[model samples]
Target: MPNALIIGASRGLGHEFVRQLAGQGWKVFATARNDAALEELRGVGAHACKLDVARPESLAGLGWQLDGESFDLAIYVAGVFGPREGAKSAPTRQDFDLVMHTNVLGAMQALLLVAPMVEAAKGKLVFISSDMASIADASSSYGWIYRSSKAALNMAVRSAASDYPGATFAVLSPGWVRTDMGGENAPLEASESVAGMLDVIAGLKPEESGAYRNYAGKTMPW
Candidate 1:
């Protein structure tokens, strides 16, 4: 069975990825901050671990724990939608810091630790970015902090792509799915979004490294 690691599998899209991958017979390493949720993922045949993406020490410990093991697929799904209300001025410093730490720094730190593992397996690395990160596609001003964080994440992955040529790297936008972050009124369901992303992931080629694509496999402007 192929091996996969999903960060932030406590709920929503991350949890769905764990469930589906385990169902498909993959050896999954799922992480979540909540012990109960980690246990739930464990019940689904995943090797669940506790993770707090915002902490460097936590990531360092995880790297030690997984030493010598490699994964065929590594997906970073940890993020926070900070301060939902868009402001005309700017998000408070606290909100900006929290969002950037969880969304951008966490992904970068995870990549630093996982890059060698990915190179060892010659697999793929995927960062779950957002469509709102696109400067070209921007028309609204909402979620500016969330938007900027993802944009930084995209840039981070693109820069790391060349560093790990053995592995395919891509940033994916899951679309406005009906997750807790996306809200109940969002048109796409969690399962539907995850399923489409899985299809897109299955078809990813090494040549397509650094590409920004949506759940439907359509390329998005950087």
Candidate 2:
């Protein structure tokens, strides 16, 4: 069976990625900060791991543990909703650093660590991006920290694409799904968003790398 690794598998859309991928028969390396919340993922057929994407030291161990390991698909899904203190501002230095550390830095580290494996396996690397990254759709600057981080992530995906000529790289926006991060009032369900995302990712190719798209597979203006 193919192997899949999903970061942030504790809850929300990340949890759904673990469920859906495992259901599809992939050997999923599912990670989350909380062990209790992660049990269901292992029960549903995944290898449970605790990964804190925010801490550089925490992530370093994985590099040593999985050195040279190849995964059919690597999905980087760990992220926070910027800092709660400044949801509207440019984000305080602390929150900005936290958001950038977890979302952008963590993603870049993961992609870089796994690049050789992905290149060797001719595999896929997907970054869970957001429609908020769309410069054309920026009606509100509510999530300034989160939005800017995702935009950076989109660019990182492009950089990764350029680094690997044969591997598939994708930047996908999973839509406003109902979850802890998306809140109880969001427009989409976890299943709906994840399934749609899986459909788009299922058909990803090298030519499609660095493209900004929604779960429906429509290109979002960047």
Candidate 3:
């Protein structure tokens, strides 16, 4: 069975990835911050670990726990949508910290730990980014902080790709899916978005490493 690791499997896109991958008979190692979420992942046939991406110590423990394991696929899906404020509305210090730490810093840290494992298996590494992170496509300043964080994440993944040539890296945008973060009226469904992303991942080539694409496989502007 192909081995896969999901960095954040608690809910939304992360949980959806677990469900689909596990149901397809992949040996999935997943992580969540809460006990209940962990249990849910277990119920879905995933080997679940307790992890809070915002906590460096928790991530350190995850690195130790997953030591020596080679994953055919590893995804960094832990992120938070911070204040829904515009450019004029400054985010509070706490919100800024929380958003940046979870979305950018945590991902950067996880990449350092997970990239080698993916390289060992010659696998693919995916970072769940957002279309809002696109600089050329920017139409508004809404969720400025969150957008900035993801943009930083995009750059981080792109820069890291050259160092880990054995593994392919992708930064994907899942679109406006109806999740806790996307709210109820979003056009896409979690299942649809994830399925599309899976297809995109399956078709990824090493030459495409660090490419930013949408769930539907359309390349996006950086």
Candidate 4:
């Protein structure tokens, strides 16, 4: 069975990834912040670990827990959508810190540890990004902070891809899915979004490493 690791498997898209991957007979190792979520993951046959991506100290034990394990896929899905304010309104320091730390710094830290395992197995490393991060397609300033963070994340992943030649790195946009962050008015469902993304992932070629694409497999502008 192929081994996969999902960071931030507590709820929303992250949790859905765990369910779908496990249901497909993948040996999934998932990380969540609380016991309840961890138990839920375990109930679905996933190996669950306690993790809060915002807290660096919490991620310290991950290396030891998965030592000697090689993952066929590793995904960093932990992120926070901060204030919905536009450019006219600046985000507070607390909001900036919370958003950037969870969405950007946390992924960077996790990549330092998880990328090696994916590389060891010559697997794929995916980061769940947003189309709002596209600089060329920017039509709105809404959620500017979130957009900026994701853009930074894209750069981080793109830059790091060269260092991990054994692994394929992809920055994917899940589109406007109806999740806790996307709200009920969103156009797509989590299941549909995840399924589309999985198909895209399955078809990714080694030469396409560091490419940015949507869940539907369309190449997206950076």
Instruction: Kindly list the per-residue Cα lDDT of model 4 for residues 1-222, writing each as its tens digit.
Output: 999999998999999999999999999999999899999999999999999988888888888788899999999999999999999997999999999999999999999999989999999999999999999999999999999999999999999999999999999999999999999999999999999999999999889999999999999988
Tens digits of per-residue lDDT for model 3, 52-91:
9998999999988898899999999999998998999978
Whole-model alpha-carbon lDDT for candidate 4: 0.95
lDDT of 1 by residue, 93-150 (tens): 9999999999999999999898789878989899999989998998887888998899
Of the two candidates 3 and 4, the one with more favorable lDDT, higher being better, is 3
lDDT values for all models: 0.91, 0.82, 0.96, 0.95
Clashes of each: 0, 0, 0, 0
- Local error of candidate 1 at residue 181 (angstroms): 0.3
Task: Provide the lDDT at 25 for model 3.
Answer: 91
lDDT of 4 at 174: 97
What is the TM-score of each predicted model, taking all chains together? 0.98, 0.93, 0.99, 0.99
For model 3, how big is the CA root-mean-square deviation? 0.6
| Number of residue pairs clashing in candidate 1, backbone atoms closer than 3 angstroms, sequence gap of 3 or more or interchain | 0
Error of 4 at 105 (Å): 0.4
Model 2, 92-116: lDDT tens digits are 7888898898889999987877777
User: What's the best-to-worst order under lDDT?
Assistant: 3, 4, 1, 2
Model 4: residue 63 alpha-carbon error in angstroms: 1.3
* Pairs clashing within candidate 4: none
